[model samples]
Target: MELITLLLLACALAMDSFAVSITAGLSLKQFNATTMSRISVTFALFQGLMPVIGWSLGTNFAAAISRYDHWIVFALLCFIGGKMIYDAIQQHEQAHCINIYSKRTICSLAIATSIDALAVGFTFSLLEVDIVFSAFIIGLMTFIFSFAGLTIGLKLGSIFQRKVEFIGGLLLIAIGTKVLITHLLT
Candidate 1:
């Protein structure tokens, strides 16, 4: 995949972490770099790790699905993107609950946010992309977005959650469509 596409994918995947980080920021009564870094690191770690896991699993089955791999990739991205949009719709009705003091809560949030990346990993495994580089980009983007979200959340609150999610979802769907079209054309 192109660097631009990988960057965009990383950003799209980071949206959940960004939103959660925003919530985490909102929960902060006072600014603490340690707490913010911890949350951001955890989110990034999971975001990066999930893809590796997914890629591993996908590679195992890549030969079986090679014939229709592009279709599968398209479907997986669309499904994840669709889910993000669906979740964004319902997210407004729910309350953000993040406990910075609890390791478990942070880890849980990180895992929840990065599930899409795991699926993305499955796609990456089939593609002619570099998994290590892709994973690094995803992790780095998640960290940057997550940290920024936390900072903004502390100052601005939860106003951007829905919009960010909605945009991220749309971006993923668009990327998926592009991949499918690119494959068909070639």
Candidate 2:
């Protein structure tokens, strides 16, 4: 793919990470640079890694990955999103329980968001693209977008507070549903 096309693809792939980062920002009580960096970096790493994995798997397994990748993504996102909504509801009376800063949650979110990238990697293999360079661009774009999304979400959250988390959860579910629908339709 041309650089412009690759860049556009990167942006497309990064959308999920961007939205998830926004949700992470919404859950934070205060903005912490370290936390934001951790989240963004984790997302970047996964976003980068998934494509390489897909490339490695190559066309031989593309059909298999495509067959189930959307389902896996849907399950992960729905579970996490549902948990966020449930936590938000419970935290209305009690202290907030979901920690966006937690390593486990971060890893889960990263993996959940990057599943699509794996499929992209498979496409890259078929296209005979330079996987390393493409993955780097994807990671770089995801890092930038994820960081910006979190910052924006933090600003929005300052005005909206806890309700932002609920919205974030809904966004996640919406994203998951969109992924499923797109695959099913195609």
Candidate 3:
């Protein structure tokens, strides 16, 4: 992929990390660079790693699914994005005791949030893409966005957390739907 396209893809991939970071910031009593950095690094690493795993897996399955790759991407992104939107809407203001920094919590959250990227990585295998550059860019963008999201949560409070999640989820679903529609139309 070209630099611009890779960057755009990176931005798209980072939205989930950003949303989760915002939630973490809201839940924390106070935000610090150390906490933010930890969260960002975890997210960035997972987001970066998932695609590599997906790409590797895709390499094995590519020939079998080459014709349906776009649909697969669309389904995966939409499933994740739709779930986020639904959760944002359905979630009530309840006390969450799950500490974001705990290893167990972080691991689960990281995996849960980055599942879409796994599919993206798979899609990358079927396209004219640069795995190293795209993964690096996605990781970097996720880190930056996640850090900023923490700051935004700290400064703004939870006022926008649900709204942001809703928007991010909607954006992902829309992107997936668009891709599916375009592919089908063509």
Candidate 4:
């Protein structure tokens, strides 16, 4: 893939991380630079690493499923994206939980949000792309955007939290469609 495509993929992949960071910021009462940095770094690392791991797994099985890889990517992306959208639309009705920034919460959120990236990594293995460069771009973009998102959420309040998730869901679905279309045309 070209650098531009890699960058776009990174940005698309970071949407979830960015949204989660915003929620974290909204819940933070005693936020500090260190806390934000830790969140960003942890998220970025996981986001970057999951794809590498997925790609490795995909690479091993690439020859076995090369003919149907696009379909697989499309299916996984659609499932994940659709689920995110569904969750967002349904989330607002739930009662707000008490705000807490424990180690467990951070770890849980980071893992939960980065699950989609693992799938993306698998997709990367099927495509003609640069894994190292793409993963790096993804990690860097996620870190920067997530940090900014948290700051923005801190200032803006949690009223628009659902909006963030909605946008993320839209982006993922769009990306999925694009991947499928490109594969079809090729």
Candidate 2 has its poorest 10 consecutive residues by lDDT at 89-98
Off by over 4 Å in 1: 92-94
**Whole-structure CA lDDT of model 4:** 0.77
Best by lDDT: 1
What would the TM-scores of all predictions be? 0.97, 0.66, 0.83, 0.88
Better of 1 and 3 by TM-score: 1
lDDT of each: 0.90, 0.73, 0.77, 0.77
Higher-ranked by lDDT: 2 or 4: 4
**Clashing residue pairs found in predicted model 4:** none
Question: Compared with the true structure, what per-residue lDDT tens digits does model 2 show for residues 1-186?
Answer: 679767766776676677667666778767788889989999999999999998898757556566676776577557656765664555342222447868998898899878877866765665568999999999999999888878977777433334544564666566567667876898
Off by over 4 Å in 4: 92-100
TM-score of candidate 3 to 2 decimals: 0.83
The candidates, ranked best first by TM-score, are: 1, 4, 3, 2
C-alpha RMSD of each candidate structure in angstroms: 1.1, 7.0, 2.6, 2.1
Question: lDDT tens digits, residues 1-186, model 4?
Answer: 667657766776777777777767776666578888888888888888888988988898888898998888888878877877777787643223524357776677677778888888888898856788778888999899789877876787666666766776777777777878888998
Candidate with more favorable, higher TM-score: 2 or 4:
4
Please give, for residues 1-186, the per-residue lDDT of candidate 3 as tens digits: 457656656776787777677767777677578877988899899999998988888888888988997788788778777877886787645423447668778778778778888888887887646788788888999899889878876677666666766776777677677667877898
Model 1 C-alpha RMSD to native: 1.1
Output the TM-score of candidate 1.
Answer: 0.97
